[model samples]
Target: MTLDDKKRVLREMVLHRRFEERCYQAYIERKIGGFLHLYPGQEACCNGVMEAARPGHDYVITGYRDHVHAIKCGTDPKVVMAELYGKETGCSKGRGGSMHVFDVAHRFMGGYALVGGPFPLAAGIAKGIQLKGGDEISICFLGDAANNQGVFHETLNMAKVWNLPVLFVCENNQYGIGTAIHRSTAVLDQYKRTCAYDIESAQCDGQDIDTVYEHAKTAVDFVRSGKGPYFLELMTYRYRGHSMSDSRGYRSREEEDEWKQRDPINILRDKLIAAGELSMADFTAIEKATDDYIENEVMKFAEESPEPNVADLEKYVLA
Candidate 1:
């Protein structure tokens, strides 16, 4: 990667990390509500891939654990905080909460909370693009546990049969809720699941931004060229628990520390420093700027936003 690209990734990853840490603080202060999922250690998965995607053309849809995706897709951080606070000024007008951050303008489809739900939705979106004769693509991100769901299989089957323009990205963080992938699945080769539908698949070290971008770019290009769907298994790990409520009883501090040593953001920063592409001063400046951005956004979301009125409770109801 060029020095410029490396710097860009560093900035985005740092911003993502700080933004998530601030969210945790907001939850503690009771400034935000709902299931607060932190994307602390998985920044590279979202940052690098979003960089590779052709923004404004390709669509991104994903299951929960989506705050990173929202930020990476260019949604104003303040609005996202407002959404978590259930304020009227939020991106979903204070209705969607933490699990359903949708930004139509940026082509970020609904951040569905249902396990494996976005897989088919992504395929359907790609089908729409194909039917309309547009060269757009959809990238569906899901957890490793989601790969076992029926929707995953069904979506892959349909996508392969129809030759839809979509990329199935499985961010295998090794565990789903409290169950690790090794315990949950007989075969741990998550990428091989795509072969059942005869789709192209590749696995990459999700902790490395450059590796992810290189592989995802190739997979995305294949789908964009009308060659049908492709799949990428990003072997990543999350530092935080499955949700804010986790008691940390399921895993040990030692295991967590081991993964922390391989932290993606720190790894990328070290690489830049070792290559003499960035200095400690530059990184410190970036960190301060990102910290200020998150803090300012939190205050902005809290001060200027209003909660939803009671009358609207049954207003958007479809029945």
Candidate 2:
């Protein structure tokens, strides 16, 4: 990556890391309720792909672990934090909580609750775009565990048959909750499993933001070229547990330490420093600023934002 590209990636990675750190702190402090999923280690997969695409045109949808995706897609941290706080100022008016954050302005479809809920929705969105002869494409992001969903196969077949402009991004973070991938998936190679539908697929290192960006860009472009749907699998690991309540006894400390040694943010920070593209002082200052932004702005915004009124309880709720 060029110096400018590295800078962009670093900035986003820092924001994601800091934001997630603060979110975890708030959750522990009892300021934010409901299930909270942090995106600390999976920053590269979300930020790298969003960097290579136009959020104004393309639609981005993902599963429950979506705060990072929303922030990267242009949703302010304030509203996002407010959502976690169950305040009306949230993206979904505090109704969606941690999972469902929908903002049409930035084209972030939502943080769907179900593992495989967004597959058909992504295809439907792509179909709508195609009918209008629009150039924009749709991105469907999910976890490795979601690939095992029946809807995943059905959606892939339909997308291919209809030649929809969609890119399915699977962030394989080794294990889903406590179950290892091998225990759940018969086809261990998530990318090649798409060959059954004759869709083009590839895999990349999720730790290297630039590599993920390049591969994701190509896949996004391929889908945008009016071709059928494409699938891109990213091999990554989450340093933290799957959720706030996960006991995490299923993995070993040595395994977690092994992945930590290859941390994406650390890898980029080291590379940028060695290439003379970033100084240690600037790195410290940048991270400090990100911390300040989340601590001061995001926290205060969520704190001051009013909770949803009981009288309006039925306002956003669907029948």
Candidate 3:
């Protein structure tokens, strides 16, 4: 990546971090309601991978920890914040809230509420691309725990059999909603599990944006080359609990502190600073700009946007 790309990624990660922090405050203040899942420590996983692919051109889907991914895939931050606020101007038109941010115009399929739900959905999208003879590939971002679902196995099998153009990215954050992954999963290494499906797979450090981007680029290329599916396991750790309601009692303070030392945002920022490619003043300016944008633009849009009208309650309903 060029110096400019690195600087752009650093600013994006910082903005995502601050945005989620504000969401935490709003959730606590009862201003935003729902099963809020904040993405703080895993910014690199999404940004790096999406940076490797064409954001608005490629199809992107993931589980509920999705605001950052949507923003990276061309969804405006203001609309994302408005979605959390359940405002009419939200990306999902105020219906989906934090869990289901859908922006098809950007080819960001959605952030599904169901665990492992995106597995088949991604495959289906890839199949459509295959039939249409388009060069687009579907990217699915999921957690370590979602791999346990039967759909995980089923989707991989179908993707391989049909030679679907899809990239399965597992954000292994070490735990699943208070349950440690080791306690629930039989196969510890998620990348190894892909071998059974005969799909190309790799694992890498999710804390480093550069590393994630490098490996993700290779994986994305392989998938786009029409060589079937590729699986990437990013060994990451989330700083917050599974959701706002989680107390994180199952995790230790020592573990938390250890992971914080390798925070994704800090990793890239320090690398840039160490290389003299970025200065403290430059970083400070970036922080200030992001803070002001969120405050004066995103938050303001969400806070002032109108709630979904009662008359349109059945507007988007399928039934």
> Which model scores highest in TM-score?
3
TM-score of each: 0.96, 0.97, 0.99
State which candidate has the highest lDDT.
Answer: 3
Q: On residues 96-177, what C-alpha lDDT tens digit does candidate 3 reach at each position?
A: 9999999999999999988999999999999999999999999999999999999999999999999999999999999989
Ten-residue region with minimum lDDT total, candidate 2: 48-57
Candidate 3 stretches greater than 4 Å from native: none
Model 1 per-residue lDDT at 174: 87
Query: For candidate 2, what is the TM-score?
Result: 0.97
Candidate-wise lDDT, in order: 0.85, 0.89, 0.95
Clashes of 3: 0
At residue 271, candidate 1 shows an lDDT of 93
Which window of 10 residues has the lowest lDDT sum in candidate 3? 310-319
Question: How would the candidate models be sorted by TM-score, starting from the highest?
Answer: 3, 2, 1
Model 1 per-residue lDDT tens digits across residues 273-314: 999988889899999988887767666755577888978887
The number of residue pairs in model 2 that clash at the backbone is: 0
lDDT of 1: 0.85
